[model samples]
Structures are given as C-alpha cells and as structure tokens.
Target: MVDIPVELPAGPETVTGDWTVGDREDIVLIAHGAGAGKDHPFLVGLADALGAEGLSTLRFNFPYVEKGRRMPGPAAHAIATWNAVVAWARTQEPSARVWATGKSYGGRMASMAVAEGLVVDGLAYLGYPLHAPGKPEKPRAEHLPVIATPQLFIEGTNDPFIQPLEQFETVVSTCQNARVAWVDGGGHSFEVKGQKRPAAEIGASFARVIAEFIRG
Candidate 1:
C-alpha cells in the first residue's frame, strides 16, 4: 500500500489515498461517500475484493474528509479531487485501463467529472443517490445523458434516495451506455434486509458483479 498525497489547485489542500497493486492491467479509482473516508470498512473490503479479482485499486479521501469534516465540500472540490487521483493513478501504470467507481456522492461526482471532460474507460456506481431522500422531484441526473462511457449502476431496491423505481429507470434510459444491477432488499449501502453479514463479505460479493461489467 503506497500513500499518495493529492494536491488540489483551489484550496491547495492535500488529500490522501492508499494504492493497492493488483496483477491486472485494469485499474479502478474509487472514492468514498459523503459520510465516510476512503478507509471506511466497506470501501476497504471492496478494494480488497477487487484486488483479489486482479484489478488494481486506489481509494482516496475527499478534501472535507481529510479535514475531519462530516459534511462534504462543494461539487467542484470533489470533482477536482477525482481529477487529481485519476491523474496520479495514470502515472503509476500508464498502460493500465483506468475506471472510476465510487459510493453515492462519490459516484455522482465522478459522473459529473466525466461529463466535464475527465477521461475514463468506464464508470461504476456502487449506489447512486439519484435524488435526496424524499425529494424525487429534484433528481440529480442532468449530466448522465452527456456521459458517453459505459456505466454500471448498482442500486438497491430499498434505497430511499432512488424510490419509485420508475424514476431511476427513466433517468438511466437517457444514457447512451448505462445499465442497472438491482440488489434485492438492499439499502443504499447494499445491505440486504434481515441478512446480516460483514462489510467485507458484502463487498466481495459485488466484486464479481463489477468485474464482469468491466470485462464486458
């Protein structure tokens, strides 16, 4: 594991990341959600599982998280952070294909960054927050249509952020190359109802799903 300091041009703040080398040429740069840092158990589990599947992984903290703030910073900062991390990842393995994957807010920001002209081979959303809880009328999906890269949205049926299933379906339809993987009874964190499991176990199960998508 190599510690990387991501320097942002705006605040000049340094965000930290942990890089886990894998045997595959496909590299994934993952970011955390609003409430957790890159070292969150769920993300660590996911990174480990992906590494086992032969995909290199880089998990990084957002600027606010690095500062120990519970609330996330503005979208611009998150986008810049994504840019910095992806840029640094490219330097590590120039021949490797880099994909962007994130949980919730992190995923959404990745999409936004891609729409704003960030380069990535593909994208995966662990659990996209289509809209704020109980605010379906204000869906955050205007940028999905412009993102031409292949995308996989792993969502839970019980996620309040994307309720009334049809809404999410409609939003995905606008994308040129996007698909959904519905997790039965799963919440925003991919936790299934009444099915207790360790965070790592749950993350491992999704590794195959994501790897298959990347391979396709």
Candidate 2:
C-alpha cells in the first residue's frame, strides 16, 4: 500500500494504491474504471499477470473512490491524481520505465493526463470508451490526436460504447501513434455473448498483448 498526494483545488488529498513489485525494471500504473475501485477483480488479475510477465504494477484509486462517491469527480482531480501517481512511480524506481493503463473511464483520464503533459513511456486502454452507448456523435477524442506516446486501444467488436466502428476508426486515425486490438464477439467489458469467463481471467488474458505492446 502507498499513499499518493494530489493537490486538489480544495486542498491536498491522498489516494491509496497497491504496488506489486516485479523482477523487471519497468512498471505500469493501472487505474480503475468509473464504476469500480482499484480492488476490482479484473484489475487485480491484470496486475498479477503483468507481474508474472516480469513487469511491476501499481494499481491505484482515484479521489472519488477514496471519498466513497459513486460518480467520478472532476477531470482535473483525476488528472492531478495521475500526475501525482506517475511522479511516485518514477521516484520509486528511477531507472525503470513507467507506463499508464486503465479500464474504460480510467484509461480515458490517463489519456487526458498525457495530453496535458503527464510523462509516461506508453499507454494501453483495456477498453477505451470512445463515447456513450448509442451516442457516437459526441466522441471523447479531441485530446487523443495530440498525445505523442504510443497508445494501444484493446476494444471489443460488439461494444456499443464505440458503435458504428467507422467513427471510432476515424478517431484513431487522427492520433500521432496508436494501435487498436479488437476482441471478437466482445462487449464493452470484454464479455462475450453466451460465453462464461471469470473477470480476472478476462483481464489476465490481455497481459501478454499489453506486455508486447509496451515493449514494441
């Protein structure tokens, strides 16, 4: 457990994180989605799998989660948290590279942080929520074009969040450097229709691809 300090407008606040040390020299910071905290089984499985791949992981909670709120706080708050967490990771392992990844909403916030100049080696989105379901007209992608770091968007083919895939592709095309990985017959949560799989297993399944993307 680690306490990361964030400077919010109201005052200085701290969020908790779990640091899973690995034998490797690189570390990845994992953030949770809007609906869950860092302890979610999916994130735990993802972190553990990454550790097995010889990579360290620090999965942390955003301010809202710490405060017991169901809704996400301001983007500025999330961005500030990102800044603090990355700084902590770099200080913890000065020589090691740091990468940022998150599930859904969390991943979008990381992208926003990088766009606004939070440094990290690369980024991977477990499922980038391009827009709300049935609402592709309002894409959350303007900042994506400005982010220079390598981005990997692991999306599900049937996810309604990115319905009418062409719009999502158009958004990806504007990025300076980006890659997309589609999960066949997958939903927003990477849950395949009529196929039963544990949440942790789904998360762990992406470890190899994520590791490969970060190394490439």
Candidate 3:
C-alpha cells in the first residue's frame, strides 16, 4: 500500500490529496464535497475500507476549497480539476481500471465530466443531490441519463437534498447502467438520528457497497 500526495493545478489554488495504491489492477478516485476537504473523516474511513478490499483509492479537494472558499467553484473549473486528477491517477496505475467516486457536489461534477466525454470505468455517488432541498423543480440531473458509464448512487431515505423518491427512481431508471442503494433512516450526511453510529462506520458501510459494485 502506498499513500501519495499530488498537486492540483487551478490558478492560485494548490490542492493536494491522499492516495493508497494496492496490488490490484483497479482504482477508485474520490473527490470531497462542497463543505469539506480531502481529510474529511468520512472520506478517510472510506479510503481505509477500499484499501482493505485491495482496490486503490485517491481522494482529493477541488480548487475552491483549496482556496478556502466555502462555496463550490465553477463547473468548468471543477471538471478541469477532476480531469487533472484522473490523468494523475492513470499515471499511478496505468493497468488499473479507473473509477470516479465522490460525495454530493463532487459526484455531480463527475457526472458532468462524464457527459463531456471524460473516460472512466464507472462512477459512485455517495449521496447524489438530485435537487436542492425544497426545490425539486431545480433538478441537477439533465446530464445523468446521457452518461453511459456504470454508475451507483447511495442515498439516504431522509436526505433533504433529494425528495419524492419517485423522481429519483425515474432518473435512475432511464440510465442504461445505474444502481441505487438506500440507507434507511439516514439524512444527507448519512447521520441517522437516535441510531448513534459513528460517521466512519457509515462511510465504511458505503465503501463496502462500492467495492462490491466495482468487483461485479
């Protein structure tokens, strides 16, 4: 196993990420969400699980967050950053199948990149924000159906970012190679009230699901 940090080129922002390379010929590259960086405990936990499964994992931060911005950077910049990271990961394991994975906003941007013809073996979305909370009409799924790469979306039943399960189902149904996993009683952050589980455990659970999906 190897942990390496690489630089991200996005103007004045210098972003770095942690990577663990296993002896396998498959890799999963993960990007953090809008409100956090690569060191987020959830990501760290998922990385641990993936490492144990013998699949390499790379987790990175976007330009905005690297610059200390709370909000996400523009779509063009996010896609560009992801492209750079993907390219770097390819250099690390040229023989490995490269899969893109992310949480929330990061996942959405990965979809956008796929739509724009960025090659990848698959995609895994930890919590896809199908639509903004209480704003179901403003969907963030126009490009999802067009992305042909095998995709997995793990969602929480109580997530406020996506509502009306029927709508999300409809979107997933249209995809040729898309699957969904429901985390019972969890919210957008995968926090289940009264369940009292640590974030790391929840993330590890989802990581196991992703490992299974990739293995299949």
- By TM-score, the best candidate is 2
- The clash number for model 2 is 0
Q: Which model is ahead, 1 or 3, in terms of lDDT?
A: 1
What residue runs in model 1 are displaced by over 4 Å at the alpha carbon? 1-9
Candidate 3 minimal-lDDT segment of 10 residues: 1-10
Ranking by TM-score: 2, 1, 3
Q: How accurate is candidate 3 locally (lDDT)?
A: 0.84
With candidate 1 superimposed using the best TM-score fit, by how many Å does residue 21's alpha carbon deviate from the native?
1.0
Compute the lDDT of residue 154 as modeled in candidate 3: 94
Best prediction by lDDT: 2
CA lDDT of every candidate: 0.89, 0.94, 0.84
Which of the predicted structures, 1 or 2, would earn the higher lDDT when compared with the native? 2
Off by over 4 Å in 2: none
Residues 1-216 of candidate 2: C-alpha lDDT, one tens digit per residue = 989999999999999999988954789999999999999999999999999999999999999999999999999999999999999998888988899999999999999999999999999998899999988888899999999999999999999999888999999999999989999999999999999999999999999999999778
Residue 64 in candidate 3, Cα distance off native in Å: 1.1
lDDT assessment of candidate 1: 0.89
lDDT of 1 by residue, 175-199 (tens): 9999999999999988888899887
Give me the runs in candidate 3 sitting further than 4 Å from their true place: 1-13
